[model samples]
Target: MSQTLQAIYAAKRKARRFAVQGIYEWQMSHNPVHEIEARTRADNAMHKTDLGYYHELLSEVISNADVLDALLVPVLDREISALDGVELATLRLGAYELKEHAEIPYRVVLDEAIELAKHFGGADSHKYINGVLDRLAQSLRAAEKQQAK
Candidate 1:
């Protein structure tokens, strides 16, 4: 990749990392989303992250959590309550991208979520995250998936 593209990719990855942590904090503490965003920003090296994408993911996912869960629940092997916090947060992020960010390919959403799960969740959690998001993409991005074939 070119230097500029690599920098942008790194920034986005950092954003996803911070967003996952912020979402995980929100899930565990039920704190207000803005507060969580503020606290996360204050604690992190914000210049290295994609602040726009981080804000979008953190705010949108928290605000639309119920809707995201409703879409995810059907694809899950177990109940939503059974999901680990990290996996749940990652899945929520993926679901939000799949649902609201159609400009992003479903494959990219799933790949990013899987990477998040591997980095933050349990040893085998990426598999579960992958399964759920894969199923979600099928329905949520049916048109895109069809066209890609």
Candidate 2:
């Protein structure tokens, strides 16, 4: 890939990392999305972060949390409420991307979510996340997946 594309992808990955923490915080504390965004910007160095993607991921996931959780219900082995906060946050982020961002390939969403879980969730949580998001993609991106195959 070209250097510019490489930069964009890196920035997006950083955005995902930040969004996971922000979403986890929002889930735990019920903080307003704007407050969480402001606090995240103030507290962290977002030099190369994709600010637009970060804001979208954080806000959309919080605003449509119920909808996102509903999408997760069937694929999740346990209750959504029973999931570890980080894992839940990561799944919601991945689900949002899978359902809303059709331009983003499903495999990319799954991979990113798994990476986030590995970094933020308990040991072996990445495997669980991979399974859940893989199932979600099957339904959410069935057409795209079919084309890819």
Candidate 3:
């Protein structure tokens, strides 16, 4: 990638990493969203992250978590309660991006979510994340999927 594109990609990856952590904290502690964002920004190297996207993912995903969960629950093999915190947070972020971020390709969303699961969740959790998000993408990005074919 060109330097500018590379920078943007790195920043977005960093944003996803931090957002996943923030979402996990939100899920486990039920902390306020702004507080989580502030704490994450304070504790992390924010210079390299896509701060705006991080805020969007953290704030929007948490705010719409119930709806995201409702969409995800049907695709899951087990109950939402049975999922690990990391997997759940990653799924929520992925679901939000798939449903709301039309500018981002569905494949990119799935790949990022899989990466999050691999880095933060159990060894096999990426597979489950992949399965759920893949199904979600088919529904949410139906036209994009059709175009790709």
Candidate 4:
């Protein structure tokens, strides 16, 4: 891939990492998304992150959490409230991307969420994330998935 493309992907990955943390924090603290975003920007080295993408992911996931949870409900093996914090946040982020960010491939969303789970969730949470997001993609990105096969 070209250098520019690789840089874009790296920036997006940074955005995902920070967005997951922000979402996790919001889940735990009930803080406003803008407050979380401001705090994150102030506390972290976000120079390399895709700031717009980070903002979009953090804001959209938090704003539409109920809607995202509704989408996740059908595929969740257990109660949504029973989910681990990291897993819930990662899944919400993944589900949001699957449903709203059609420009991003579903596989990329799954991979990124699995990475987030592996980094921040309990052991084996990545596997669960993969399974749930895979199911989500089937429904939300069915056309893209069929074309990829």
Clashing pairs in 4: none
Q: Which stretches of candidate 3 lie over 4 Å from their true place?
A: none
Candidate 4: 10-residue stretch with minimal lDDT: 100-109
Model 1 lDDT per residue over 31-54, tens place: 998999888878777998899999
Off by over 4 Å in 4: none
State residue 19's C-alpha deviation in candidate 1, in Å. Answer: 0.8
Our tally of clashes for model 4 stands at 0
Q: Per-residue lDDT for 1-149 in model 3, tens only?
A: 79999999899999999999999999999999999998888887799889999999999999999999999987889999999999999999999999999999999999999999999999999999999999888888999989989
Over the stretch 2-115, how does candidate 4's per-residue lDDT look in tens digits?
999999999999999999999999999999999999999999998989999999999999999999999999999999989999999999999999999899888888999999
- CA lDDT, every model vs. true structure: 0.90, 0.94, 0.93, 0.94
Residue 102, model 3: Cα distance from true site in angstroms = 1.0
Which candidate, 2 or 4, would have the higher lDDT against the true structure? 4
**What's model 1's TM-score?**
0.95
- TM-score per prediction, in order, is 0.95, 0.97, 0.97, 0.97
Counted clashes in each candidate structure:
0, 0, 0, 0
The sequence of per-residue lDDT tens digits that candidate 2 reaches over residues 1-149 is: 99999999999999999999999999999988999999999999999999999999999999999999999999999998899999999999999999999999899999999889888889999999999999998899889888888
